[model samples]
Target: MDTYSTATLYINGKWVEADRGASFEVTDPSSGQVIGVAADAGTAETERAIAAASDAFPNWRAQNAYTRAAALLRMHELMLERSEDLALLMSLEQGKPLRAARNEIRYAADFLIWFAEEAKRIYGSTIPSSRTNQRLTVLRQPIGVVAGITPWNYPVSMITRKVAPAIAAGCSIVVKPAEQTPLCARAVFDIFDEADLPPGVVNLITTSRPSEVGDAFLRSRAIRKLTFTGSTAVGKMLASRASESMKRVSLELGGHAPFIVFDDADVEHAAKGAALAKYLNTGQACISPNRIYVQRGSIGRFVNVLTDRARRLRPGSGVDESSTIGPLIDMTAVTKMEQQVADAVGKGAQVAIGGERLREDGLDGGNFFAPTVLTGVSPAMSIYNEETFGPIAPVIAFDTEDEVVAMANDTEYGLASYVYTKDLARAVRVSEALRFGIVGINDINPTAAAAPFGGLGESGVGREGGAQGIDEYLDVKLVAHVLGDAVD
Candidate 1:
């Protein structure tokens, strides 16, 4: 509770109280309890944060990549040094297990480390000119003043994912984290000050009114790029707003990824992969497989194995050592899952294992939903089309490869898809055929700091992470100059 009290807006490199001086409480989803208060920002404060980021852009961009890299290295070290404390804080507010939070911190820190090195390698190309005397040098320059709009599902890693690459590419940013999880964002920003990040290089604001903050970013010419991670509907709205100014937008939006298991694959490994893909983050992840497609021959065995694994999980507070399944971020999330599950069941889906909300003595009033498995889910059900961003795995049976591939590509989202098979040729065929931006063949974890991550179609625009990640924050400039005449 004391930790949330200390949480405040970070602007121009200072911890600030909201101009209106009003604050809101951040709740612990596991206990349905208020953990801490955060300063509630309005339009004025949001504009100030933007102004600060815009003001700091030139100086931060002027620094050499080596200097920037060195600062990032310091930040990386601090994150590692304070990993335990940060993870516990995250677990309290985020409702994820302490161990999971710890792993997220490590994963988040790896971005800092990877991007720190990448900072020094913003390479440009020298192109040959048709005219011998003319010289052409293609340069990559930072797209100034980025705005990061992140979701609550991954408080630390998501911020690091956006901020690290932007910083590495020499772009200053103002971030607006989800209202539910501002404490984790503030904790990460605390390290920025200690790492000696210049004032205005990074700014954070929390507001109940997201529209005000979004309008400020969209309308301001100073904010060159906007990066968001959330639902597809919101992403579409943001993109529409950004288009008015022709502001660059990078959106990591919603997904209903398909986990396709073929008859020829190893059933146990495929089941394990399904659990890893669908149940991590309690299936709040956008890339979590919303629908599982198994060939008729494999469907029954796969369900048995997956349910056996899911039954091992206990939905409880993150404080419990044996608790692997934590509460959803809020009641809203729990309610949504309830609605989706109901819709599926109403339409003939059968629950294989857990289904009802968990309400044991210790779990009462908390946002805990049993990790569920549903069979006989068809395309007619809403769960088949909509992303059930919960701990429910609905297995849909299919008969043929062509039919399954068509079913997998049926959704508007093309974010991520997982395929499990032993045949190298089949893996290649499916991987090439999937319309998604990311396809995991025989593996559930397809994302890394060194790999480009994002999706096609409604899943959002642009890529984040790897060398391509920094590219989004940069603009390509072609320099053409007349050189001395070449000797014949």
Candidate 2:
């Protein structure tokens, strides 16, 4: 994984550096060390990428679905063939554990495989006509060139989630990956290149100047669609900009998901699920549980088990096979965790486990924080209202089912929520009551390639997976025909 030499911009089927030779240093969050240099593309490169996508769109859309599906399937195969390398690269840049990184690679590649089959199934329908000589038909067509802005967290999967569906729907795309993990994006584009995708059908530009690229995408009439995954604020800004040009837009934004544990739930099992949900990817995920609610009767047992699990987690460099928890993406994430914990404690919350940074055990150089659990967390605390995108879980107790449901749905975000209960009737009732796009009833990980994944409200619009994913890149056309006397 020699990222120093490997990181470059992929445009129009060529690997190149910035036009002005400008570049930025990429650091490994685990060690706070410069791992590589990535091309810092400006507005000029962005426009060029947009032009390339526009130029490639017509021929790409004209190709039959089978041709497109073949290329995507090839990408899937190449990704799997090089999964280990991909996983290592991601672990280095993104700061997730090696095992987690390996799992992410598989999940990311699954998007291409899933959409490859989905490409062949973009069906249109025929409508019955009122007159004997009249006919009506409907068609689903590609929306043309797309501009994609992916986030740092889950860099590989975020790119595939957008690019796979766009390509599967016959649209060409230009992607601007997060500055922190551009090497992973470059690696993905390498697979695309080896798959023999047509030049300009897929392009990548690594840049620190995200605003410049975003503005370029907004101003370009050539880019007909915009898809972004990041903060709610940024998503809103991008959506507003896209709306000014009437460009089609889809956003997967921030979330403050709630994890609920009922008395009916197996406390030990629920505790295990909570630990995974709260700490996956070091809680940087948009769908990670921000708030944990336990029934008053189960709170004592649940907290004890959860705290034991947190205490047992080993935090270090992601490359360490023995490490279960990894460093935060940067110092900012570490600072946020500190601030949140401090705020909660000042508001009378008690730290049941860890509550400070990890400065020992060779973790001083990186952005590392202890896995923390806060009890007596109240609505008055900042952690209760804000999305704590770190390894800190705030537990709040509730008296009844309705009370828990109300507490879970008290946020503006509506992304992912979790409810643990063995009562079948109770699971259905609470699941339906929670105002989120995806709910895991007695299950922690609910996302899959074959299921629609997205958020509601400020959590953002549109979906990214399953059969409906391709639809985000397509447009519908209805044709009505009137026939004269038969020529035969």
Candidate 3:
């Protein structure tokens, strides 16, 4: 794969240098090597990007739904054509297994495909008027310019999830991707440029000074909507800032998801689901299973199977096809994982599989933590309360349905929850009782491009997919018609 070294910023449909002529190195997490150089921006550059989006908003939003859908469909096709290159680029910069990278590319493209169709389906309803000669109809209009902030993890997917809907709804946007993985953002913009997207329709700015950029986004009246995906703390900060201007805000923040296994669940199937949910992306995902609760009768067997499955996973560089577990994003992630494991062990939790980091082979210089399974983890332990964000599974035992439901819903984060059971009534009951925005009944992957994804409570506000996803970038306007005369 060719390195995107010397990648420049895309603003107003043209590639330009940063005002300060600054650049940053994008590192490959798996090999601890510099992969590419990306343009760096500050507050001034961010403001310029915002200005560009604002300038293009009027004409871009004036296009009909079919025209917007056609452009989105072209981008979607281009994305699929470059799938292989994009996947390798993702693996090089983001450090996930190659298969995972490919899957993410496909998933990202699916957003474009899904939203291309949804663009033409933004329908409004008519309200009945009291007078026969009067008419009332609702209108959905683009909310002008949107400012988006995407995280490093799942770079391609995160950007696509935001940009696809924004474009589909005929809104121009300025995107600020995480500084650690700006190359992926540049690559996506390259595809957008190839699709001949209008100048200023989409702008990219990479900067380390996120605070200054965020302030610029908030200060600009042209930016009517702000969308962010990151930690709950940052999400709260952005929400607070946007509140002053009364701007629309959509946040997909942190999560501490729960996985519950009933006594009647097939132990093998449950184990497989747990490994898939908790170990993908080294469990760095926001919706990763943070806690697993099994019925007392099945706890022993569940732990045994999970430990064996986790032990069999090969931890190595994401470039390797055979390696299922890849390195964490950085040393800070490794250090945090170690502290959580140590805290759990000190609280009487037993390490059932791995409890150490892998410094073997060529991995000594990289950030790799062994797949771990802990038993006897209790609410008293820190691991039980905090998200591990690594390939560590902490198992807790529960006696009945009510007890497990209470245990699962005890967290302030309510993003996603999983329930494994053979009983239809229990599945429905548990699904309804769970406070999460997304619930999986005997399924690990509840997320789909066609489904609405978001969370409740401190997990942040608003929906990000399905029909509601585009709504975040749009506003409702009521149009009334008076047949006879204008009323004062």
Candidate 4:
């Protein structure tokens, strides 16, 4: 089987090669060797993409909801048909297990399906008015072209999460998928093209240089909204630049999520869920539980079970059937994680379970890290305030529920938090008190396209998914008139 080296950027309903037509070397994370190079974007190429998307906006916004929904439905179908290919591409660049990648592909498709149905639900309200024969109505209108800058993690789903809602709201989009994992985004964009989307309604650019594409979009007066999912530092930089044009910004940034296990919790179930949450995608998830703050009594018991489960995980190349945890993206993440681990260990944290990088010789050159568990993490440690973004879960014990809640809310991030209490009354109280965007009680898979997803404070500004998603890409308009007379 041939591996793809370069992927073309799609713009104005056409696949385009860069003017310089440069290339980049994409390495296989498992092997830390160059696997292939996709199309590399220079300044000129990025400008062309922006221009293509800018030119398409007027006509795209003119499209009715039905027309837009049909295209989305078509794109959704094609996504299903080529799931295998896209999944392989995702695994190649993203370093997730092929099955996990395939699952992500399916999850990505669900957004299109959901928003396709949601398009019909775009409705407005008529305002109640005094004065005889006077009428007033408020209509939600599309907000021109949206620039979607997605990170490498969950590339396909992130793209779908933004694009589906934008398109369903009758707005066109330009997606700047991460240069590392551009193939999946390109594949989805291909489905949109094959679905017969009007030219400029959807475009894509793959670039190793985020600055090149970012500068192009920032300088352009045509792009109306900038939606980004990445680090808080970068997101802030982009937000500052986008502010020059006063562009509407939607940001989903970093998270240092916490999992609170109360004394009354189901220890076994909570531990399993925490294992899945922390180890999913090797803990690359923004919402993955990084800090496990257990009630003091339950702490010892929790780690015993958690350690037992963590030891049994399969770690190897993403394609391996026996593998449960997969590699970090590459040496960069490994190095960063290693440094953070060292820092935490230096700050007096104890290595309770798995730690250290896996030897490639044993696993046929795969980049695998053993699932690591640490305990006694102090609040001052880097691992507490910063998101490690790796296959590491640290356990910290708290004395009381209030103390646990205070500790969880102490961080600047509020993307996600988990509570394992079974008491419904206690659950409601703690859930509301967590100060995070989403909360789960005795659950792990709390992510749903139906619910609004985002956080407060530094985590992000606007919400994504659910009915509120369209609101981020829309401008509300109110009209008032007197039916019986010019002046009522």
Candidate 5:
């Protein structure tokens, strides 16, 4: 792979070093080597970026929807033109397989395309007035400058999901990309610059000082909205702080998704789906299945097929062509996987296949864990109670439909859940019963550029993908017109 470097803050359409010349090294989690350095932004830079966005908001909001849509379309073209490079860069920094990285680039670019069309579709409505001499109308307008805080898991996609909609809605934004993956954010901004977006319309600030920057965002009155994608703890803290200013907020937080396989489901098909849902991106996604429930009658066959699929996964560096699963983000992730497995085993959960980290081959220096399947996982085990953000799938057996649905909805975090069944009535019943923001009926991949992606409960608030996505960056105003005013 070629060495890539993008170590600067992008503010007001220019790439500049941090104010104090502070920098932080970015390491490849797969190889434990410093890939590049990113500018370490502070409170001052964050404030400046916020100010820039605020200054540019009115003109951006004043532009016709078609003009903004054209810019987004150009960005979409640039992203696709550099798809391979973006994929390689993401793979090098974030440690996902090159193939998966390529897919993410496509997914990221699709957001720009989707929102480009959606920009022109921001429709308003006219309502009948109660009084005879009055008319009523509803208008959707830009919510002004926005602040986006994205995570490292899906670096490219997360940024586009937030920024594309904001831009499409005619709002200027200041983005704070995750410290672990600032290059991807910088790369996206490069596309924006090449697309000829106006100065101050989009700003990027790479920072090691998250809280300082976040506090600056909260304190800035010019920022009207704040959107975030990260852990639940961090989301809650930011939400609490933003409350002081009553800022509009949207968050996509942690999830403990449940994958259910009923007896009526095709055992082989269910197992394949389970493997894909559980181990994609090495199970680092927020929507990854944490607890898998199989009907008592199909548990044996499901376990056999699932274990075979797990054993076939080739864990290696993300850039390696033959690798199927890549390393976890860092040592902390490895430690969490270790602790979860130890707790499950201590509580009498039996490991069906792999139960340890993969220290063999060239994976010792990086954070690599074996794809594991635990058969006897129960409520007593910590794996059942906590979110396992690694490649560990714990299978729990249930006999009744009510039991499975209850078990699936037991968690406080309700982001996503999956149900597999051939019976139409049962599928509908179970799908309606699951208390999640998104439900997959015999489908592991339910999210797309046109769907509403968000969560219920502690999983966070607001939607990110569909028509509702643009609404997050907009404000509704009801206008009442009198006959006398119309005459004048």
Candidate 6:
């Protein structure tokens, strides 16, 4: 075990250590072991961090969009230069494969630059007033201090999903990255420093105790808005707390995205898509498709091809360059996924190809599980109702478009869904019927900086990507200026 035990927090545009000087272990999810310790912040530290962000908001928000965009552009450039450093850090902490982490870093930077360009593009229009003497227009203004709570999975991207747009829109923020994967996210704050965002504009705090950190902001009047990326359970709680203060909230919560395979689709391609989509980041992603529904004619071929793809996955530590499947983020996740597997099997699901944890190979004693495939899965199984968040693909068969669509929409989550069909009509039909904010027609991964992302139902309110992203931080106010006095 490596002996380094402390990391820094960035608050008010400066790197810091907690006042009590306590540190908590940072485990490598890839190895089920400790890699380092980060500063453990509590309410007191959170208070200070909030003040920093609150104090900086007026000045930051008053600056021109071009200035904010310039900083974001510079940070984007630095991010590209330091890509390897951040990506490796992300993998080491988050337990995702290195390439996935790298892709997130690049994507996170894209969020920054994309929002930078969008910053100046926040459009306001002149209202046509019937009154001869009055001219009315609307202008979008920054909302004030924002509190951003990001999750461990896709830590870098989630942070950028909030921070980049908030700052680009001229809102200051206090960030609380998930304890499991705070380092890389914290390091990205260094870019803010390099970009010279005004003092107290953006702050980062590492706290193992989320309730305490969260409550601080929840109770604070200075924090006008809150954003979260996590499970639906916690998202609701956070929303409730923020409600007391009537704070504006944005939640990007959980998903059990349904992957529907129509009989008309190519089975091989669908199988590959299902395998990759289900197992990406060990399926910890909220957008990750966990429920696979194949039509009657396609079920046999799809399962056979999918199981083969799942079986081919090699499990190893995130440190290993060749390893594709890494461990879940922590021991809790391992336990959770293990129970999910047992529960599914106990409920009569059949293991198709790879089903158990992998044998620990060498140096690091990796927490590796074989890519698992479960066939004959029922909607009542835990894997369907709840998210497994692991490299497990459970295939459930359905007949007819209406049946599949009903199966897809039968969930509280409306985050994302996938449908594979050659016919454009079927693709359009399934896409419209699937109750998700984002849907994949032929593509397994359906996301880009240019498109708006988020969901329709309990998944979350409001969108996060595209030009609409920065809109979350903006407030439109009607300004009525009298052009001239009416001559009777």
Across 77-181, the per-residue lDDT of candidate 4 in tens digits comes to 889999998887777678888888988998888889889988888899999898668889999888888899998889799999999999888778888888777
Measured on C-alpha atoms, candidate 2 has an lDDT of 0.92
Off by over 4 Å in 3: 1-3, 486-488
lDDT of 3: 0.90
Instruction: Give per-residue CA lDDT, model 6, range 370-397, as digits (tens).
Output: 7888988997688889877788888998
Clashing pairs in 4: 5-37, 6-38, 30-367, 314-324
> Residue 245 deviation, candidate 3, in Å?
0.7
Give the deviation of candidate 4 from the true structure as CA RMSD.
1.6
lDDT of 1: 0.90
Off by over 4 Å in 2: 1-7, 485-488
lDDT by residue (tens digit), candidate 1, 247-301 = 8999999998999999999988999889877888889898898999999998889
Candidate 6 ranges with C-alpha deviation above 4 Å? 1-7, 483-488
TM-score of 1: 0.98
Check candidate 5 and list the clashing pairs.
none
lDDT of 6 at 143: 90
What is the alpha-carbon lDDT of model 4 when measured against the actual structure?
0.85
* TM accuracy, model 4: 0.97
Weakest ten-residue segment in model 2 by summed lDDT: 1-10
Clashing pairs for predicted structure model 2, backbone only = none
Clashes of each: 0, 0, 0, 4, 0, 0
Each candidate: RMSD to true structure?
Answer: 1.6, 1.7, 1.2, 1.6, 1.5, 1.9
lDDT of 3 by residue, 230-284 (tens): 9999999999989998899999999989999999999779988999999999998
- Candidate 2 lDDT over 349-389, as tens digits, reads 99999999999988999999999999999999999999989
- Model 6, C-alpha of 250: deviation from truth (Å): 0.6
Candidate 1 residue-pair clash tally: 0
Candidates in order have lDDT scores of 0.90, 0.92, 0.90, 0.85, 0.92, 0.84
